[model samples]
Every structure is written in structure tokens, then in C-alpha cells.
Target: MGSATAQALVASSSALNAAQGITLDVAGELFSVGRLIGESTALSGALADPAAPAEARTSLVSRVFAGASAPVQDVLRAAVAERWSSAADLVDGVEELAVRATAIAAPDADIEGELFSVSRLVAGNADLELALGSRLGDGEGKAALVQRLVGASLNPATTLIVTSLVRQPRERRVRRLLNRAMRIVSAQRDRIVATVHTAAPLSAEQRSRLGAVLTGRYGRQIALNEVIDASVVGGLRVQVADDVIDGSIAARLADLRQKLAG
Candidate 1:
């Protein structure tokens, strides 16, 4: 996001945080608005056009989202009032707000874990990934597939988030979109994601210990998402934000080969 868009998001988030009645319902409404804008190039262009006056864009939002609740309207108004880099960024910003709002409404839920589980499921199954991420596929059909896959297990917040992303992936890969959602959920809880790739699944005890070590190192709580990669051979590769700790045997072997070649 550009500086202006980021500033707008922060301001809007602060307002939502301060509001008393913001709920998952509000987030759902925002998601609906985002989907509507994403599917309609004309609407997105009008809302995101920097050349258009902010008042006009907001007026447009009020008309298009007339039935949205006050809280939802507040968010949409704030979103459309900002200067976006492009029409697509406007949609992306709205979708991001929807995810964040869901996270805020479901503070006690394990939303980050749920999003990660869905991402892993999609990553492991090529057909499922294609079905959900396919641009040519019907949006409703993709939503139905998401419902069948995880609707029963997830909370309404997770369901809305996953369904919205799958239905309108825009230019994002499904796994990438889910990962971004997980990060947003983690940020809502004042935590960071620690993705662990290992040859075998870690025991609960191992996971706890790793979490403790990472927490001590980063000075923040970690939400661990484990990926079982047979190619790892041994040890693990840990990624916390941009910092990576690659202790896997595969990495070491590759380093040794590079040194030999040098």
C-alpha cells in the first residue's frame, strides 16, 4: 500500500476499534460491498478515481451501500474517501478491512489457525486449489466448494473471509491470499506468524518449545503454521516475517555444494 492508503486504513481501523457495536455482521457487509465493487469495473473506477472529488465518491458509496449498517457505512465511507493507487487497490483495501473487522469481532476465535489450515489444505490439493482459484470457475460454485470443505469447522468470521477471497481472488493465488488473511488475523491479536517447514510433523511439546524460543527472540507471541515437507530431510525451516532460520538438511546440503563449487 502507498503511504496515503496505509494512513487511511490505520485511521479507519482506529475508528472501528473505538466503536462499540462493530460486529461480524458489519464485516460481512463490507465483504459484500468489496465483492460488488470488484465485479463492477465502472463502480470501482468511480470510487477509486483520484480525479473525482472525495465528496462525490463518498456520496456514491452512500447510494450504492445505502442498506449497510451505520458501522459498515462508516468503514465504506472512510475507504472511498481515501486516494487509492488504482481501482484494484480500492477493492483490495476494502477486502483487507473486511478481514481485519472479522478478526476484531472474533477476538477469542482461532481465526489465524483456521486460515492457515485452509491455506495448507489448498496447497496440498492441486485440484481443490484450482477449483477455488480458477478465474473461469463460477464464483458461487467456488463459494459452495469452500462451504463443503470448511464451512462446518470454521466460525462465521472465517467462513466469510475464506469465501470472499475464494470467490474474488483478483490477481492473488489462493494460498497467498489465505496467508495474508492469517497475518492480518495475527496482527489483530498483536502476534506474528511463524511458519515452520519440517520433514515430519512436530509433536505438541516441540511446537510449544519452538514457540517459546521464537517468542523470546522476537519479543512477541507467535502463531505457528507447520508445513510437513518431506523434501526438508531433517530439522526445520522457520520463517518469521522476513527473517528466515533455515536449519533443514536440504538447505545445508545445498550450501555445502555451493562451497565446493566455489
Candidate 2:
């Protein structure tokens, strides 16, 4: 992220935080605005143009998002009023705000965990991933497919988030979109996500201890997204962002085999 975009994100996030009585409706409106802006290069450029007056950008937001609720409009105005490094960054900024809004509205739901699960599902199913992420498919079809597949099991907030993203992926792969949403949701809660792969699910106490250890080391709250992979054989493989801690028996055997062969 560029310096300007980072500053703009903080500003927009603050504006979202200040809004009272945030609801799923607010998140829907923000997503609608983000999608419209992302689809129009001209609009995004005009809004994010550094030379343009901030007043002009905010006025454009009012004209374009007139149908949005007051809170949504307020957040958009705040976003356009700041300087972004690029037009695409402006669109991403709005999308982040929308994701954060969804996280806020669903305070009781495990947004990161649910999104991670969706990502795993997509990663494991090639046909399903192609169907959802293919550019040739109509947005409505993708949205309906998403609803039919996971809507029943997901929280209302999660269903709304998944449906909205599948409808307008904007060239992101399904896994990429899901992971990005999970990252934003984790950041919104002031936590980081650690994906743990093990032969079996971790016990609640094990999970707590792992989270505490990671939090102490990283100096931030840690949210674990556990995956049960039988191929792990034993032990755990944990990843946070780019860093990996691989202790799985499969990895150890592979290392030992490579050493003996050399």
C-alpha cells in the first residue's frame, strides 16, 4: 500500500467508526457504491485526481450516490476527500470500507473464519472455482450459485458478503477475493489471521494456547483459521501472511528424504 492510500484508509475507517447504528444495509450500500466506481474508470479517476478540488470529488459522490443512505454517503465523502495513490487504490479503499462495515454489522459472527472456510472450499473445487470466477458468467448467475451453495450455512452477514463479491469479482480469483475480504475483516477487528493446517482439529485449549503464543510474539491479537488436512500426517503447519512455521510430519519426512538423497 502507498503512503497516501494508507492515510486515506485510516481517514475513511475513522469515518465508518463514527457512524452510529451500522447495519448490513449500510454495508450493502457501500458495496454498491464501490462496485459502481470500480466499473467506471472515468469516475474513479475523477474522484481520486489529486489536482481536483476535494469539494468537487465529494460533490461527485453526492451526485452519484444520492440513493445511498446518509451513513454510506458520509463514508464515501470522507473517502473521496482524501488523496489516493491511484484510481484503483480509491476503488480498493471503498471496498475495504465496505468489508469493514460488514464486519461491524456482524459483530457476533466469526467473519474471518467463515471467509477462510469459503476460500478453502473454492481452492479444493476446481469446477466450482471456475464457475464462480469465470469472466464469461453473468453476475446474477454467480450470485445465485453462491446463495445456493453456502448461504444456508453462513451467517446473514457472511452470505451477503459472499454474494456481493461473487456478483462483481472485477477480475479477482475467487480465492483471492475471499482472502482479501478476510484480511480486511481481521484488520477491522485489530487482529491478524493465522491459518493452521493439521491432521485434526485443535482442541479449544490448544487453540487458546496457540493464539496466546502468537499474540505474544507478534504483539497483536491473533485469529486462527484451522484446516484439517489428513495429509499433514501429524503436527501443524501455520502461516501468517508470508511467514510459515511448518512442523508437519509430511514436511519433516520430505526434508529427511532430500538430505539422505543428497
Candidate 3:
């Protein structure tokens, strides 16, 4: 994220955090507003234009989202009031706020885990990914497919986020969108997600020990998203942001091959 966008997101996040009575319904409404803005370059541009008067920009938000709840309107105003790096960044800022709001509303739900599962599901199915990620796909149809696929298996908050994202991907691939949502949810809880790949599932005790070690190293809670990958051969490959801990046998074998070649 650019500095301007980062600052804008921080401001918008504060607005969301301070708002009272935030609910899943409010989160849905925020996503609706984001979808509308994402679909219109002109609208997003007008809102993000640095030359435009702040009052005018926020007034547009009020006029357009008059039906939104007070908190939604407040967040919208706060978003447009900032100087975004780009129109797209403004749209992203709003989406992040909506995700944060969902995380806030569903305090007890395992939203991060649900989003990771959905990410894996999309990554594993080319047709499903294409259906949801392709620009040519019908937005309504994509949303319906999401509802049918997830049904009641996921938390209501997760369902809302997935359906909203597929309805208006705004050129983001499905996996990217899902990953971003997971990251936002993790951030909401002051934690970071560690994507761990292993030859087999980690036992509960193993997972607990790994999580504790990572938490201590990072000085923050660590949420693990475990992936069972046969290619890993043995051991674990863990990624937290840009840092990768590659102790997997596959990586070791590759290193050995490189050394032999040298």
C-alpha cells in the first residue's frame, strides 16, 4: 500500500472502530457502497480527486448513501475526506473498512479460518475460480454460486464477505481478494496469519507449539493456516508475510541439488 492509502486506511479504520452499534448488516451496507464505487471510475475519481473540496466530496457521499446507516455514512465521509493515492486505493480503503467491520461484528466467528478454507477451495478448482474471478462472468450468478457452495457451512459473516467480493471483484483475482480479506481480519484482531505447508496435517499439540513459538518471535498472536501438501515431502514450510521458514524436505533437496551442481 502507498503511504497515502495507508494513512487513509488508518483513518478510516479509526472511524470504524469508534462507531457504535456496528453489525453485520452495517458491514453488508458498507460493501454495497464499496461495490457501487468500485464499478464507477468516474465516481471513485471524483471522490478521490485532491482538487475537489473536502466538503463537496463528503456531500456526494451523503447524497449517494443517504440510505446507509449513520456509521456507514460516517465512514464514507471519513474515507472521501482523506487524500487517496489513487481512485482504486479509495475503493480498497472502503473495502478494508468493510472487512474490519465484519470482523468487529462477528467477534466469536472464525472468519480467518473460513476465508482461508474458501481460498483453498477456489485455488483448487479452476472452473470455480474462473466463474468468480472472470470479468465476463455474471455478477449475480457468481454471487449465487458462492451462496450455493458455502451455504450454511460458513459463518454468516464469512458468507456475506465472500458473496460481496464475488459480486464485484474489481479485477482482483479470487485468491487475491480472499487473501486480502483474511489479512484484514487478522489485522483486526492484532494478529498475523502464518501460511504453513506440510506433508501432512499438524497434530493439535504440534500446532499449539508452533503457534506459541511464532507468537513469541513476532511479539504478536499468530494465526496458522495449515495446508497439507504432499510436495512438501516432510517437515514444514511456513510463510508469514515476506518471511519464509523453509525447512521442508523438498526445499532441502533442492538446495542439495544446487550445491552439487556448483
- Among the numbered candidates, top lDDT falls to 3
Which 10-residue span in candidate 1 carries the lowest summed lDDT?
11-20
Error of 3 at 196 (Å): 0.9
Candidate 3 residue pairs that clash: none
Q: What tens-digit string does per-residue lDDT give for candidate 3 at 1-262?
A: 7898999888889888999989999999999999899989999999999999999999999998888999999989998999899999999889899999999999999999999999999999999998888878688899899999985799999999999888888788999999999999999999999999999989999999999999999999998999999999999999999999999999999999999999
What RMSD value applies to candidate 3? 1.5
Off by over 4 Å in 1: 249-262
lDDT of each: 0.87, 0.92, 0.93
Q: Model 2: which ten-residue window has the lowest total lDDT?
A: 159-168
Candidate 3, lDDT over the whole model: 0.93
User: Residue-wise lDDT of candidate 2 within 1-262, one digit each (tens)?
Assistant: 9999999999999999999868999999888888889999999999999999999999999998888899999999999999999999999899889999999999989888888888889999999999998999798899899889998989988888888898888888989999999999999999999999999989999999999999998899998999999999999999999999999999999999999999
Clashes of 2: 0
In candidate 1 the C-alpha lDDT for residue 196 amounts to: 97
- Order of models, best TM-score first: 3, 2, 1
Candidate 1 to truth, TM? 0.90
